[model samples]
Target: MTFLKRGVPLGIAFLMGVLMAFQYYVPHEHSKAFLELMTRWDKIIAGFAVFIGAYSLFHLHYTRIKRRAAGWGYSFFVFVGAFVTIAFGLYNGGEAFWHDKKEGTMFDWIYMNIQVPAGATIFSILAFFMASAAYRTFRARTVESTVLLVAAIIVMLGRVPVGALISQYIPVAADWIMGVPNLAAKRGILLGVSLGAIATSIKIIFGVERQYLGGGD
Candidate 1:
C-alpha cells in the first residue's frame, strides 16, 4: 500500500521529469518524438482534469443548495448558467458536433451577450478599485513615494494627447522613464521569477519537493 501510494508515482515523476528535461538539450529525433507524445498526453490529462474540476464545482454548489446555506440562492443561478451554456454547446445550434459553430449560433450568442458583458463589467469594476488603491498608495509622503507619484502622474498625462499639446517635453520624458527604468525593473523581475521557477523544478525533479503529493496523506 505504501509503495502504491508513494513509490510508483515518485518513480514515474522522476523518469518523466528527466526525459522532458533532456528534450531541451538533446537535438535528437527520439527526443522530439517523446516531446510530441508527451504533449498529446498532456492534452488528454487536461481533458480529464476538466471533468474533475466541473464535478468539484457542481458538488460544491449542490452541497450548498442542499444545506440551504447562506447565499445558496446564488448557487441555483450557477447551475442554471452552467446547464444553459452546456445545453447550447451540445445542441450545437442544430449543427453537427464536429462542425464549427456559426456566428449567429446560440452558443456564440450566449458567449458574446452574456459572458463577454459579464467579464467586461468585472474588469470595469476592477478599474475603479485600482484607482482607489492608487489614491491610497501614491501619497507624496517620502522622497521615494514623491518620485513614484510624480512618475505616475507624468506617465498618466503623457499617454494622453493633451499632454503633448500642453508641453512637448512631457511625453518625451515619459517615454524616457518607460523605456529605461521601467524596462530595467521589469527585466529584473522576470529574471527573478525565472530563477525561482528553475529552482522549484529542480527540487521537484529530485523528489525534494513532495508537496505536490498531498501533505500528511
Candidate 2:
C-alpha cells in the first residue's frame, strides 16, 4: 500500500517532471512530438477533472444543505443556479445539444444578464475596500512610506485631467516614476517568483515535496 500510494506516484512525478523540463531545451523533432502528445493527454485529463470538480462542488453543497449548516440557505441557490445554467446550456438556444452555442441563446442571456452583472457588482464593491486599504497604506508614517505616498499621489493625479492643468511636469514625473522605478520593482519580484517556482519544481521532481500526495515532511 505504501509503494502504491507513495513510491509509484513519486516515481511518476519525477519522470514526468524531468521529461517536461528537458523537453523545453530539446530541439529534436521527437521531443516536439512527445510534447504535443503530452499536451493532448493533459487536455483529456483536464476534461475529466472538470466533471470530478463539479461533482465535488455539488456534494459539498448537498452535505451543507442536508446538515442544515450555517448559511445552508445559500447552498440551495448553488443547486438552482447550476441546474438552470446546465439546462440552458443543454437546450442550446433551441438547437441540438451538440451544436455550438451562439448569441441570443438562453445560456448567453443568463451569462450576460445574471453572471456578468453579479461579477461587476462584486468588483465595484471591491473598489471601496481598495480605497480603504490605500488610505491606510498612504499614511506617511516614515521616510520610506512618505516617499511611497508621494509617488502614489503623483501617479493617481497624473492619470486625471486636473493634474495636467496644474503642471505638465507632474505628469512627466509620474510617467518616469512608473516607467522606471515601478517596472524595476516588478521585474525584481518576478525574478524572485521564478526562482521560487524553479526551486519548488526541483523539490517535486526529487520527491522532497510530497504535500501534493497528501503527505508532508
Candidate 3:
C-alpha cells in the first residue's frame, strides 16, 4: 500500500518535474514535442479534476441538505440553480454542447439576466468591504503608516474628477507617486515571488518537500 500510494506518485513527480525543468533550457524538436504531449495530458487531467471538484461540492451541499443542517435552505437553492443551468445548457435548442446557444434561449437569458447581475452585485458589495478594510488599514499611527495613508487618500482623490477641482498638484503628485515608487515596488515584489516559487518548485521536484503526499505516518 505504501509503495502504491506514495512511492509511485513521488517517482512520477520527480521525473516529470525534472523533465519539464530541463525542457526549458534544451530547445530541441524532441523536447518541444515532449512538452506539447505533456500539455495535452495536463488538459485532459484538468478536465477530470474539474469533475472531481464539482462532485465534491455537490456532495457537501447534498449532505448539508439531507442532514437539515443550519442554512440548508441555501443548499437547496444551490441544487435548484445547478439543475436549471444544466438543463438549459444541455437542452441547447437541439444544438450540441460544443455549439453556441442561440440568442433568446433559456441558457442565454439566464446568463445575461441572472449570472451577470449576480456577478455585478457581488462586485458592488466588494467595494464596501474594500472601503471598510482601507479605513482600518490606513490609520495614521506611525510615520510610514502616515505616508501610506496620505498616498492612498491622494490616489483615491486623484482618480476622481473632484481632486482636479481641489488642486492640480494633487493629481500630478499622485501620478508621479504611482508611476515611479509604486511601479518600482511592484517589480521588486514580483521578482522576489518568482525566485521563491522557482526554489519551492525545485525542492518539490527533488522530493525535499513531501507535503503534497498528505499528512500521515
Best by lDDT: 2
List TM-score per model, in order: 0.91, 0.89, 0.89
Q: After superposition, how far is residue 138 of candidate 1 from its true place, in Å?
A: 2.1
lDDT of 2 by residue, 17-103 (tens): 999999999999999999999999999999999999999999999999999999999999999999999998998878858987666
After superposition, the stretches of candidate 2 with alpha carbons farther than 4 Å from their true spots are none
Ranking by lDDT: 2, 1, 3
C-alpha lDDT of residue 160 in model 2? 93
Q: Mind giving the per-residue lDDT tens digits that candidate 3 earns over 1-217?
A: 9888888888999999989989989979999999999999999999999989889989999999899999888998888998998888988866856787666778888999999999999999998999999887778889999988888889988989999999998899899989999999999999999999999998899889989899874
Error of 3 at 195 (Å): 1.8
C-alpha lDDT (0 to 100) for residue 151 of candidate 2 = 93
Better of 1 and 2 by TM-score: 1
Order the candidate numbers by TM-score, best to worst: 1, 3, 2
Query: What global local distance difference test value does model 2 have?
Result: 0.92
Better of 1 and 3 by lDDT: 1
